[model samples]
Target: MKFNRTAKAHWKGGGKDGKGSLTTESGVLKESHYAFKTRFEDAVGTNPEELIGAAHAGCFTMQLSFFLVEEGFTAESLDTQARVYFEDGSIPKIELELKGKVPGMDESKFKELATKAKENCPVSKLLNADITLKTTFES
Candidate 1:
């Protein structure tokens, strides 16, 4: 099986003064506005790094859930935060913070599964950056 996702961006003007809109085929982001200020400065709207973080977080969390279910366990809830670092026009690293609870599961096993997810998630494999996973188990 194969799946393809698409997002398009349109820009007007130039550089810091330019304005842009981004849209995805799924329509979740329909003409979402973005600009240099939003990317570099603190302004409203989305940026590439933010979107990457969201994608990583979502993918890792779901992957963990799937692994747990396949192992005859279920997570009560899972939380993940992906922090992307962009430095000197390059993305050097991505850090994933994971927290979740699965009934009747040991912390060691949970951490092991989370590490596996980080290594195997599609986005993690696709990204050209160092990825690190830190997982915490909830009582």
Candidate 2:
């Protein structure tokens, strides 16, 4: 299966004082604002890294749920957080922390499924930075 998603951005002025708005074809981010302050400081808006982290967490959780059901386990709940770190003018690392409850599944199996999701998910595979995962399972 092949899917193509479109997102565009418009910016005015230069760094530290410029403003930008992003939009996606899905309409989930229609004219969302972002800027240097949003990226480097605690400004009132979304940044590219924040968007990426959201995407990663969402993708991984969905993938994990799919695999869990395929393996005959039901996903009671799942929560994931993706933390991105930019250092020295480049994105260096992304860390994923996952907590979940899968009825009738053991910890080892849960970890294996989470690892597989992290390794094979579309966003995780597409990223260029280092990715690490920590997971805790609830029975």
Candidate 3:
């Protein structure tokens, strides 16, 4: 099966003073700007890089949750933080941090599942950067 999603952005002016807006084919509109900080800062929209990180983190967490359930374990909560670092002359690096509370699951197993999720997630497959995963488990 094949599918596609569309998002559009419009920018004006130079990097520091330029501003932009993004709209998904699904109709969600956001504002962005360099002055706002990120590629699309608080000028009113979302940036592509930030959105990518969010999607990757969310997808990995959901996949991990499903894997846990399949292993006969359930989590009380799972929180993921994805940091995308863009340096002066190199590809961006994505660092994923996950913290969760799973009852009756050993830390070793949890780590295994988290690692699998990071490795197998669709977004992870699309990126060409250094991906790192750090997970913390709690009973």
Candidate 4:
């Protein structure tokens, strides 16, 4: 199977002073504002790092859900926070913090599955950075 997705960006002016808008094919981000201040300073706008974080979190969580189902378990809740560390003009690391509640599940199994998900998720595979997973399991 094959699929494709796209996002468009329009920028003008200098790097630090320029302003841009990002539009996604799904329309989830329809011409959303993005700028240097938004990325490096406190501003009311979205940035690429945050977008990557969101994608990583969503992909990892969904992958974990599939693994859980395959293991004959269902999660009552799963919360994931992906922290993308941007330094020296590059993303050096991505930390995925996950908390999950699954009835009749053990910590060992949860950790195993989460690790697998973190390694196998599409977003995880796409990025060239160190990825780490921290999981909290609740039964």
CA RMSD per model (angstroms): 0.8, 0.9, 2.7, 0.7
Compute the lDDT of residue 88 as modeled in candidate 3.
Answer: 82
Runs in model 3 lying further than 4 Å from the true structure? 31-37, 40-45
TM for every model, in the order presented, reads 0.97, 0.96, 0.82, 0.98
The number of the candidate with the highest lDDT is 4
C-alpha lDDT (0 to 100) for residue 37 of candidate 3: 55
In the range 47-134, model 2's lDDT, one tens digit per residue, is: 9999999999999999999999899988899999999998998888999999999888899999999999999899998999999999
TM-score of 2: 0.96
Candidate scoring better on TM-score of 2 and 3: 2
Better of 3 and 4 by TM-score: 4
Give the clash count for each candidate.
Answer: 0, 0, 5, 0
lDDT of each structure? 0.93, 0.94, 0.82, 0.96
Segments in model 1 whose C-alpha atoms lie over 4 Å from true places: none
Candidate 3 lDDT over 31-110, as tens digits, reads: 43323455534444456677878989999999999999999998999999999886784546999999999999889999
TM-score: model 4 vs. ground truth: 0.98
